[model samples]
Target: MALLREEDRQYLENLFKENLKDKVKIILFSDKAAGSKLVVPGRVECPYCQQTREILEELVSLSDKLELEIHDFLTDEIIAKKYNVDKIPAILFEKNNNVLGVRYFGIPSGYEFSSLIEDILDISRGETQLSPTTKAFLATVNKPVHIQVFVTPTCPYCPRAVRLAHQFAMENPLITADMIEAIEFPHLAEKYNVTGVPKTIINEKVEIEGAVPENIFLEYFKSALKD
Candidate 1:
């Protein structure tokens, strides 16, 4: 069965027709096996790897400018290391033949799908929807900032946090943002202590529990830089 609805596919086709100005490469790392090498020794599972590949294939079909490259996390260790991908079902976006720091650590389905679309648009345009103030603040960031927003496919507010961090990454090359599906990465969830949805951890230091306003999020981001 197709994961994307017919209506949704049509909508994305139109959206891509109007918005995409440049090529966007979707680099995916996953294990084809039912049990992935990245998982625990006794844990025989790769819950979303197969489904995630299907969704990505459908997505690339929607636009000529969009492309998909699939790789095995275990066997393609060198490529995975180049992208700093250590998890199965991970995705990285590339534009102008330059890979960006934006990524998704699981299947970007449901509400999070919109976030993926917007990210492609932003990368193609080489800009973001952030206000001048936010952009200005991001420009001042000299050091690297890693923003990881934990989410679930069903969460309504998760997209906001994901998009915000991704936009920050779009504005500044020093910032790398990720949308991590908490359910798909249980170990990471426990490591980060993510109990609720839209939990954003900036630089693994500053943490926000819910979707927050841009201004408040900036405050947390700045705090992360201090640590």
Candidate 2:
């Protein structure tokens, strides 16, 4: 059985035909067993890895410009280390074989699905939908910044925050943004003290608790540099 509904598949087919431009490569890393040395002890088996793969397969089928590459989390240790992926069900987007900083550490379902679509379009076009002010601010960022947005798939507001962070990555090569599903990565949720959804941790220090606007997000982005 396909994870995507017939209507949804049609919608995506139309969307890709109209919006997708250049070839977009989606690299996925997953394993049947979720536990790894980096994950918390006794962590639950990856509840969404199979579903995530299904979704990617469906998505790639919608467009000729989209392609999927699957890798095992444990067996492909060398490749995972090269991309710095420490978790299963991780996704990395690329264009013309050049990987970008946009990443997802969990299944991008529910509202986060749109984030994945927009990211594909942005990467294909080699641009973003961010405001000029935000782009200007990102240009001043000379050092590396890591942004981790903890979310649940059902959270309605989480995708905005995730997309905002990803767009920031599109603006600057120094920015790396990830959308991490809180339920799949319990240890990460505890480490970041994520009691609420859409919690964004910048540079593992500056924290924002909601889906704030671009201006406010940039403020926190600047603050994270200081930490």
Candidate 3:
């Protein structure tokens, strides 16, 4: 049986056909020690697993822009440790030896799937779709900015915030964007007091809750830099 329903497969196919203009290198890390079992309870099955390989195989074959590289987390401890990967099915996108983006825990399914596609597109373009004002403000930023957006798989608004943070990180390497699944990493959620979806923590000091406009996000981000 296919992991994705027939309609879902066609939907994904149409998505790749319409988008995917630049090269997308997707590094998939699989934990052999936890093979076929989810590291986080209730997480989706690993695409490389026997039951789901066909689904991934079909998806990969449909897109020339996407390059999939698989690594066994247990065996390739060095690479896994380098990326600080402690979970299965992690994704890291890089270019010219710099980390472009990351999906730290599980598959970006459901509504988050569109955000995943936008991430790839933004990374491929090597630029962000930030407004001119936001771009100008971000250009003046000299210090490092680390943005972590905690989310759940079911949140509809989480992706907008995640994509904005990702775009900022992609445009400015001094910035790092992390999309943390709230339920998957309970400790993190508790630490940051993530009571709601789309919570953003900047530089461990400034916390912005909810999906604000890009300019508003930049204002909060800039304010954090001054502290």
Q: Given candidate 2, what's the lDDT at residue 168? A: 94
What tens-digit string does per-residue lDDT give for candidate 3 at 25-103?
A: 7776774434444466544344433322333455566678777777876678898898777766666786655666455
**Best lDDT among the predictions, by candidate number:** 2
Give the alpha carbon lDDT tens digit for every residue of 112-209 in model 1: 98898889888877778888898988888899899999999999999999999999988877889999999988999999999999999998778999
lDDT of model 3 at position 170: 75
For model 3, what is the alpha-carbon lDDT of residue 192? 94
Backbone clash count for every predicted candidate, in the order shown: 0, 0, 0
Greater-TM-score candidate between 1 and 3: 1
Candidate 1 residues lying further than 4 Å off, grouped into runs, are 34-44
**Residue-level lDDT tens digits of model 2 in 1-227:** 89888999999899889988789999999874543446555443676888898899999999999999998887788999999999978999878777888999999988899899888888988888888888888999899999999999899999999999999998887899999999989999999999999999999879999899988999998988984
**All candidates: TM-score:** 0.92, 0.92, 0.82
Q: Which wins on lDDT, candidate 1 or candidate 3?
A: 1
Q: What is the C-alpha lDDT of each candidate?
A: 0.88, 0.89, 0.73
Residue pairs that clash (backbone atoms under 3 angstroms), model 1: none
Worst 10 residues of 3 by lDDT: 47-56
- Where does candidate 2 clash, by residue pair? none
Q: Candidate 3: global Cα-lDDT? A: 0.73
Q: In model 2, which runs have C-alpha deviations exceeding 4 angstroms?
A: 32-44
Arranged by lDDT, best first = 2, 1, 3
